[model samples]
Target: MRRGMLSIVLGLALAATACGGSGGAQQGGALQGQRITVAAVWTGAEQDNFKKVLQAFEEKTGAKAEFLATGDNVSTFIGTKIQGGQAPDVVMVPQVGVLQQFARNGWLVPLSADVAKEVDANYAKVWKDLGTVDGKFYGLYFKVANKSTIWYNTQAFQNAGVQPPKTWDEFVKVSQQLADAGTAPMSIGAADGWVLTDWFENVYLSQAGPQKYDQLAKHEIKWTDPSVTKALQTLAELWSKPNFMPGGPQTALQVEFPDSVSQVFSDEPKAAMVYEGDFVAGNIATTGKKVGQDANFFPFPAAPGGSQAPLVSAGDAAVVLKAGKNQQAAQEFVKFLATPDAAKVWATAGGFLSPNKKLDASAYPDDVTRQIAKQLIDAGDAVRFDMSDQAPAAFGGTKGAGEWKILQDFLGNLSDVQGAVQTTAQRLEQEATKAYGS
Candidate 1:
């Protein structure tokens, strides 16, 4: 089956419908006595925050709230429950990439007209559009975080006598400088394929800009395009640089996101900077360091020929299942989630940036978090979702994973640039063609 561009099933389908919109249904459809269960993909401190919100909801509504928590295998559990006919009433998913799949399979209901209208009026059209597929708004998002930014230790940069780089050339120079200073310039984890994908997507955007890259992923343009090849070539240079990356490209596979983040603050911290989403701040805080005071960020630099880039971001969406047994309760829950109060709760509690444009960001205690929020707002229409999560899993999943492995191998053998890229481009084209036939 050639993966249809519109049918690949990515996007935050669960996140979209989690909140019923303004006109979804006021306060009375069917949830009165029915116990509403919530299934979440978060655990640990994150899970506790969600539990608190659910508890608050239960206390306010007098309904029993049951939670099914799965940290990493959530999608598997969700798939199993749905297939087994024991689907939960509400589910929160992190990206629209996976949610689009669920929605295509009829796993979610579109946001009711009342709810849809309010969402359109209140938030940026892109976010609302992210939740809408086939003209149906099926998801709502409370938080959005920038992903294509670099986090650096301020004092470290001060001591190194270099400013944060704002262009790819400058970034390369800084990497060399840090290497000279015996510091791991980049806390990169290429071992984890997704980390490499992050580097690829940012480079692609910085080189090709969003529209063409979007087109390439959708198969409107070929992967062999000069821009994509250029992007990959640039990434190859970074990965190939001697002592340029921490723990080595192979380390990416072994390093978890937190491990990569903690390295930025380690006493003998392997690296002086990290490139990841705003969410890394949470991972850093877990290591007992503070964001803003102890850390700061700069947008990834622009490619030589690329236009000014948009901020790359990712976040979860609250979705209401189409087959949910309690329509009224689910709808009401959606409404509750859209309120300013809900936005505040999500930001402070979940360590996320709220999607509610009207919320007072000053309420956030973390300066880094607040600055991120302000950056998003100031960038306004320039924010784009994480490219991997925005594209189909084939492009962003296994095949994408395969691309990273090839890069890792090539990083160790820089002399094989053409050979490595030629082989990778062919493989990617074949997979994309199979998944998304021309």
Candidate 2:
């Protein structure tokens, strides 16, 4: 087994280097000495893993690649750069809506024919559709997040005599069991509305299915739809349980995402589990807990009456900006990133998952990550992009005014589910009218 694993690893490394070498040979002297800037909303370890990918690109193509960490406000920063005529050659946009907006405004360069062909061959149809806008390809989805995971402390579950739940009923029973043992069953970072949005997406996707999820995201269905109510009521089952959440819903609304992870894995754990993306594994490690041993995750179970288990997923797409200084080099770098070989670099680095269908599951460093990659692949068409991220920024992405604030309110007051859903419907209608003048 060890020999076979080593052979697979070596094969991937050779393939990556060969892909990079061929890319350099094709670009030849045109991109050899050019400098290109790439901007992304990554810092710390995430940025570190990305830099390794960039370094490989530079080494292979002989082009200097500069990474600009855009922090959390990439849209603002990218807009400022574009206005100043200094947009990065490649900008990694986290939201498809924003990428489409930029493409529609003519700020993005359509992918070269070669790059488009590579994307078509390497990515799934959904990913291809996401990168293409107005019938033209503009972005390459490189990294993906599996949001249908619930990270848990293994010891905590063992101590509570509860196994990981496989269905929503089981999930509830497990939560109550954990709570009865004097431990908080879950930790929620409702303070970050995005986290709340994720919670709702998983429930909505699983309960209402993808067709309605698509409608809700595109505003074809009102937020007050019966499906919305049903999802919320399902979520409220756990939320309403006494002592099920750490410090209850009010305290959850004050806990940030990192703190929520800490609460689950800390030396004195306040909670047993946290529902979040695969990235939470890294956060668990940071708290001095070993991910596969001390902390691990199970797939979020199917809600009762739901069609199938749903996987709410999100990814960053690399789009070339028309205003960039080195278009040729930028295009080459994006093409490099689209390859399975380039994806393996960061996939093996941990805390990273690629949407490239061609990437090998064996490329991931551990069984936990491998499971995540397999879950994402197995989800296939069942996976839906985070609905809030796909919605208009005014309604879904705004910090304190729209979906975020309203959902935070609901978290603090579970008894007002109908009121909250109705208000969300009205807000979406108003925001959609303003955005589309409809």
Candidate 3:
């Protein structure tokens, strides 16, 4: 979604002319002793790749950058930090709703004009729009994902004699075939509510079409709309059958997101498929299966009204906090993120996609990730951001509440509950109305 930047060698050259002190000679006077702590939901390999960016930053600016793993509930964790006057100097926010909410609350500082200029040069207008609140820039996208994908096990597909399907009916038929052949058809990580939201979004976008999808995302149309009803019914067709999931719905509810991905590629796995963003590749890497041969992905199938699903995408954005003592260093750090060099660090490491138009396609380590990035960039005006991410935190970002909880409830009790689809849609609308005040 954005720009490329200067080499670290340039920073070292420029530092000598800007400062007189021996220590400040190698480090610019402005950022000599600053330490910026960044908070995000990334951990393990995700955090490791990010640390590479931090390593590059320290080499350039002489400021120490440390990462704080805020776990899966980043919005709530950061909110609590801001409330206590202990906010991280920078944050890699995953939700647009959370970014806009923080901006509106005046918790984030406006990025400098230089950062905006870089954004204008490298990113698409849609990316700038997502990071901007009320025409002011408070954040910029760093990494992006194409969420419209379903990864499967090649061995399982071969055993079940099923190819990737193109439509909802065909997908269901394939699922049944896989089940009948004694292959676990799907591995859902319903324990994490966000995964369920991705499922709903892919189906709703494909079936309802873009116009209605946009209306519902902004709450201009209620969740109880006919489009929403149809999407829920479509999802119900799969959720109603316990046989479709590994160890049935109850066991599926206990599995976390990473385990769900690993299972798809595991030897004698509990299940053979997982759905989410392209980031699933990161988890797949640890499972010892090569992508494209042992594990592969296909675009989410088209629903009834659409020939194909539009690309539903999401990205994490970097922002500076006004409350941090190292806010100036934090701004410079965000500025570095705009550069191609920073993106290249993660791109070559796999499981990373940058929105920067200038980032070379050759930077990616593998063809699968490169092609995924190409799909995202080429989607152009056809891209729609995650719908739940566009809604308010109370309605979309909260755990055990809001759309996340409502959808998870619907999935868990699909068959036993009467009128569950309608009930779930009405509940979603109730939360949206309360959160959006519409």
User: Best-fitting candidate, measured by lDDT?
Assistant: 2
Which residue runs of candidate 1 sit more than 4 Å off their true CA positions?
Answer: 1-34, 59-64, 70-75, 247-256, 390-395, 399-401
Better of 1 and 2 by TM-score: 2
- Cα RMSD (angstroms) for every candidate in the order listed: 6.6, 7.0, 5.6
lDDT of 1 at 179: 84
Give per-residue CA lDDT, model 2, range 206-275, as digits (tens): 9999899988888887666888878877777668779988888989988999999999999999999999
lDDT of 3 by residue, 228-335 (tens): 888888788777765799888777778888889877888777777888888888778889998878888877888777756668999899998877767667777887
What candidate 3 gets wrong by more than 4 Å, as runs, is 1-37, 61-88, 247-251, 325-329, 416-418
Per-residue lDDT for 19-122 in model 1, tens only?
34432222222332446667777777767777776765665454556887745555677778877777777777776766787788888887665566666666
lDDT of each: 0.68, 0.82, 0.80
What is the lDDT for 413 in model 2? 73
TM-score of 1: 0.85
- Candidate 2 residue-pair clash tally: 0
Q: Rank the candidates by lDDT, best first.
A: 2, 3, 1
